[model samples]
Target: MLRITPRILAVACIASGLITAACASYAPTPSSDLAGTSWAVQSIDGQPTSARSPSVEFAAEDRISGAGGCNSFSGVYEAANGAISVRALGRTEMACEGGVMLQEDAFFAVLDGAERYARQQDRLVITADDGRALVLAPL
Candidate 1:
């Protein structure tokens, strides 16, 4: 046998309403902006890439692939708590034209040093421990 009490029912309704509102107030998911995004590098360490625009793609499940201005590259990346680490990069040895090689080298160096990242409006900014930064936007 069960008894219905108005006070108990009212308390349950209030708790349910609060839970629903809390869920709705949460921030938007990062996957919409990060995962599967084709981010192209615009600047590194406050200097322009000066060659071909370097690009990065964050694949699902810790995989990353991109072109570093000259050569095609693939790497592993992990992000948690707004911190990121990039490693295990492998690239094709295709020769670069003019200053493209320099740009590639610099790009890799900055990427290797990435420790954290932020999304600013329409851009993705990756920062290093030494105050260097790499700025990227959707390609």
Candidate 2:
């Protein structure tokens, strides 16, 4: 039989309290002000996109979804202040023509390397560490 001694009970309570405090302190930070905003890519890497420009939508749950010129992609994004990151990106595996495929690849590359973002009065620019950028406007 297991006996509950005073010392054992005290240790267990202390451990439990410590665990609870740690868990509470580890809660996720608040979402960014960009939450719930949506934009359509107007230009990528300083060049204009074709008629079928890509789009991006930022959801409140740290989710991001968008078109990649030829494929639809979804991923989780985290942003704090002006810095941003994208991870867990998954996309459809559809094929397209040469030019469309090239454009799609460029778009995905920039997103994969996203480092910072800014919102101007009527435009949003996402920039990568290597200086690649995506300029978008409201959808």
Candidate 3:
């Protein structure tokens, strides 16, 4: 026969609480600060990037510089309270492989629409106003 005593119930509750606290400690927390951070594009809109991936550096003075997979680009960005906006982006016009150019175009489009960003663990995800997302990994 089994008994359901108050002591057993209390021990079970404590065990559950301890387990939850352990898990919360290990969970990924949102990262702070974007300046001086650099990352290489891993994917855009859930599509994996190629070997020559676009890269970005959140430089000082709200300036951002990166390779657009085919061309280098620079722009100014504003980030505050989890919201982000990229603007005035300009890129070199050098020609590249067709696939690479297409990828660059898509990347630029997403940047143009960027509205928010989050750094989860090692991944930095920039999401657009239209729900498109760019996933990047530390460089």
Candidate 4:
């Protein structure tokens, strides 16, 4: 049977280099900074929510994957210039406690309405048309 061990997990993290805290300071436009990076959700709607470790990674072929605090998700995305769009977004339906599932719902809602994105140092700010926003830092 396939199993995940702590050592394997650590190795995977190191190999993916998804930790944003230790990354070098890279200042750039949102598109370039976001095209090929994994970002961790720091806040939603301007306030930090008790969502478990949530993150998003933008990949080539218009693909994306990450956690929504409660469950892992993967889907397609389209980002160009400073505009961003997330389509076909899908996530696991696992039930979670502590309002994590609610946070996930809110997070996806913001993403669905996402209109613009900006890069502030290592942070990626995605704002919706309704002024809602998701603050993410390089993961």
Candidate 5:
């Protein structure tokens, strides 16, 4: 047999209410402004790197178009709420010497394996499942 007490019932109700409120607060909110806009790479892991602050533009057709330093690149983008992914990227080959080429190569390599995206204030962050993150800001 089980007995119900007022104190126990009150605690249970309070716990349930707190859990519900926590879940609601943590839920991600989708931003329509993020779509169909251009953004520029700002900093990586809080370090300043101007190697190539390329711009990315999202399209209504689920595509992402951007300039990879000296070359142009395009890819497919899929996003929902707080999650975003880019796939099947293709880029033009243009000769760029010095640090620009190196930066472009690094940037493209990161994008090729990008698995998730997050927005923080005015910055957009792309990340891999391994925890590596890249930050970008509005252009």
Candidate 6:
């Protein structure tokens, strides 16, 4: 028969409690800075653009608001443990000429796959697993 002495049972209970506490402490807290912040797109692949870069700003709650070249856009954002997902993005439909449309499309594409984000001073850096980065400054 398998037997556990009182001391052994106490030790096992203590170990389990310690592990639970450690895990709870290590869990990530939802970012508060992400709310009410405006970020101006800086660079993609380390190249600067003379054209006006796209910008993203967040609301106080689950909404992500931004500008895509000639139009304003808004969406919902969900993030956990460095992974980000955007959904229900609704943008104003405006006719943008030439490069503006192209830039907007590219900006949306990158944001759709954002995996992680970091803050550097007044700047925000969003990155993907493939080493692609989008640097932005607070507006």
Task: Give candidate 4 misplaced runs (Cα > 4 Å).
Answer: 1-33
lDDT of 1 by residue, 107-137 (tens): 8888888899999999999998777889998
lDDT: the better of candidates 3 and 5: 3
Q: What is the model-wide C-alpha lDDT for candidate 6?
A: 0.77
Which portions of model 6 show Cα errors greater than 4 Å?
Answer: 1-31, 129-131
User: Model 2 over residues 23-106: C-alpha lDDT tens digits?
Assistant: 785544448876888899998899999987888988888999989889999999998888999999999999999888888898
lDDT (10s digit) by residue, model 5, range 1-139: 7778999899999999999988785533433346677888765445455756767887766778898778899988777766677888989988987777767776776677677788888888887655666788888
Q: Please give the range of 10 consecutive residues that has the lowest summed lDDT in model 2.
A: 25-34
* Model 1 spans > 4 angstroms off: 1-33
**Clash counts for all predictions:** 0, 0, 0, 1, 0, 0
For model 3, residues 1-139, the per-residue Cα lDDT tens digits are: 8898999999999999999988785543323388888999999999999999999998767888999998999999988778999999998999999999999988999999999999899999999998999999999
RMSD of each: 6.6, 4.9, 13.1, 16.4, 11.3, 8.3
Q: Write the per-residue lDDT of candidate 6 for residues 4-114, one digit (tens) a residue.
A: 999999999999999998878554444456867788888865765337788888766668988877888888887655566677888898988878887777777777767
Considering only N, C-alpha and C atoms within 3 Å, which residue pairs clash in candidate 5?
none
TM-score of each: 0.73, 0.77, 0.76, 0.72, 0.68, 0.68
- Best TM-score among the predictions, by candidate number: 2
What order do you get sorting by lDDT, best first? 3, 2, 1, 4, 6, 5
Residue 66: error of model 4 in Å? Answer: 0.6
Clash number for candidate 1: 0
Decide which is better by TM-score, 1 or 2.
2
Candidate 3 segments whose C-alpha is farther than 4 A from its true place: 1-32
Off by over 4 Å in 5: 1-33, 45-47
For model 3 the local lDDT of residue 49 reads: 96
